[model samples]
Target chain A: MKKIESLSEYRALLGENKKTHNGIDKNCFLLPSGMEKFISAGKVYYRSYDQGILIFIDENSYYNLYYYIEKGSCFPVFSCEKPVLIEELSQNGSRDAYIAANEARLKAAGFGFYRKSFQYEIGIGAEEPQRFCTAEDEQAVKASGFRYDTACYADFRPQIISLWKESLDFGDISGDDLALELSQDEELLTVISGDGAVACTYLYEIVGRDVSEGRHVVTNPSYYRKGLGSFVLGLTLDHLRAEGIKRHYTWIHEQNIPSVRMHERLGFLQNGRSSIQYILK
Target chain B: MEEMMQILKGVRPDVDFENEKLLIDNKVLDSFDIITIVSEFNENFDIEIDVEDLEPYNFNTIEAMWELITKLQEEG
Candidate 1:
C-alpha cells in the first residue's frame, strides 16, 4: 500500500490505456479535488502483478481498486482476473467465464452474494402526444439559470463523462472523435451552464419507423435538485415527440432509483426485461 | 384562455405566460412542462390529445392552448 506519486509511474501502471473510469485517466488516480483530498488525508496504494498493476485509493470510507491489464479486452466481460465491483456501472454483455476467473479474488475481497440487476428498456408510445414539460418546468429551468442547447456534446465530453460517472453507473467513455460523432446526431439535446454541458440525453439506432433507442440521461451532480433533469429532458422528449418519433426507449439500471422515478414520472412504463449481476459472497 | 394561464402558472409560477409567445421555439416551456400542461388540459377538458398534436404552435401561447383544446373538443 504505497503511494505511486509520479504521473509517469501511474501511466506505466495503466499501460497507457487512454481510457477513463470514474473521471480517472491513466495518468492520475483521483481528479484534482479527490487528489488533493487523498494527498492531504487519504492514501494511494499500488501493487504489481503478472497481468497488470493493481492501484487502490483508500479514501478512509471506501476503497476504489483498479486492475490495468496489459492485453485482452479490458471490458469486464472479457477479463476479470482482479475483478472490482461488477455493478450496473460497467456491465457490457460479459460472459460467465470472466466472472468465473475472479472467484478467488472476489472471495478474498469479501464481496457479497451474486445479485441480478438490469438496465430497463422502457418506451414512450406516440399514441399520446408526449407533452412531458410544463410551464412550471419552464419556471424551474429559469430559476436554475441554465440555458438549453442542442447538438453541442462534442464541446463538453469531459464534463459530460464526469457528470455521468458521478450520477449514473457508466464505464469507459468514448473518445473525443466518437463523442463528436454521437453529438452530430440531429436529435441530441443538452443543457449548458457556464462553458460546458450540465446535462444531456440522446437517442440512437433507428429501429423502425421513427422509433429510436435513447440513452445517456445525465445531470451534473452540482445541479441535481435544481429541476435541470426535468427541464432538459422535457425539451428533448417534446422535440423528439414532435419529430414524429413514434416511440423512444431507454435502458435504466434497476438500482438507479432516481432515474427510474424520473422516467416513470415522465410517463415511461417499464418493459419486462432484465440482466444478472454476479457477485461472490 | 385565463383558465389555461392559471394552469401554466400553477406548474411554473415565475414565468410571465401572457407575454411569452414563443414557448417552444424560444425554449420557454420544456417537454416536461408541456406534458404537465397537456395532462392538466386532458383532465380538465376531458379530451384525448395525441403526440402528433403536440406541436409548438399548439402550446406557444395561451390562445394557442385554448384553440387546441377547443379544436380537440370540437373533434370529439
Candidate 2:
C-alpha cells in the first residue's frame, strides 16, 4: 500500500473505483473538498492498496475509518493513539461482507460491536407542525438572557469541544474538523449563549437542495432541564424552514431514550434505517 | 438578466448579484440560498432544473445562471 499525499491522486483513485463498482455511491464518502480541508487541517490520513483506498479521520479522542474496496473485500490496518470507530451505513448491502472480512482482524485488535443507531427524519411541511419549545419556555429562555444566533465555527469551538467531551460518548468531533467544515457553503453551526458561556449548540449540513442533516446538538450539562436544547433546536428548524430546506434527518443511538423522546417530541420519526458502530480501543 | 437579478435580490437583498461574479466561490450564496434560487427560477421560467444542473459553475455569476436557464429552456 502506498500513502496518498495529493488530493488529485486520491480523487482519481476514488473515481476509478466508482467507475468499476457500479453499486458504490460517491456520497457515502466525504466530498473531495471536505477531504482536502481535513487534510489541510492535518486531521485526515489515507493510503491506497491494490484493491482500494482507506481513509482515517482523526478526531481528538478517536478515529473514524472509511474504506472503498474494488473487490468487495474490506479490511483496514492502522495504528491509533486512541479508540477507532468503524461504522457501516445500513443502506449499503456490502456491510456484511465488510464485517466478515474484517472480523478476525478487528477482534485481534481488541475491537467489539459498540451500538446500533436509528436514523430519524422529518419533512418541513409534510406533516402538521408541533412546537418543540412552548412560548413560555422561549420567553423564559430569552428573559434569562440566553440568545440564539448563527455564528462562524470559530465562535464556539472551545465551548463545543468542552461540551462534547463531557457529554458525548461517540462521534466526538475535533476543533480542526469543525474548522474544516466551516469552509463549506452548506454547513451551519448555531449557538445559544448567555452569561459569558455558550449554553447550547446545533450544527447541521445542507446535504441537498431541499435536504439537511442534523450533524450535532450539544447543550452544556449545567443547562440541562432548562429547555435550552429545545429552544435552540426550534430556532434552528425555523431557520432551516426559512432557507427552503424541505427535509431534515439525524441519527440517534437506540439506547439514548432521552434523545429519542426529545426528537419524537420535535416531530422527527424513525425512518427505518439503522447503522452499527464497531469500536477498537 | 434584469428579471433574474430581481429574483436573486428577492431571495437575498444584501448581495450585489450584478457585479459579484463569485457567488458560489465567495460564499455569497449558500446552499439554502441556492435552493431558493432554484425554486424561483423553475417556477418563473417554467424550466426544470435537475439536480445535475446545480453545479457551482452554472451559478457563480448572473451570466452563468442566465446561460444555464437559457440552455434548460432551449432543451425543453
| Best model per DockQ | 2
* Tens digit per residue, CA lDDT, model 1, B1-76: 7777777887656467889887766656543356457656866787755434666788778888889999999998
Q: For candidate 2 chain B, which ten residues in a row score worst on lDDT?
A: B27-36
Reference-based TM-score, model 1:
0.41
Off by over 4 Å in 1: A1-126, A165-168, A171-187, A192-207, A277-281, B1-76
Report, for every candidate in turn, its global Cα lDDT versus the true structure: 0.54, 0.69
lDDT of 2 by residue, B1-76 (tens): 7789888887666577879888876666655466557756876797866434666788889999999999989988
| Candidate 2 residue-wise lDDT, A1-281, digit = tens | 34456677656766676566533311133334556766676676666655456677777567777766554343445566777787755432324554466566556656688888888887774343664456887788889988778874467677776676676564544455555555567788888888878888888987754667897788897788887776777777877887777777888889989888888888888865567777877
- Fraction of true A-B contacts recovered by candidate 1: 0.00
* TM-score attained by chain A of model 1: 0.49
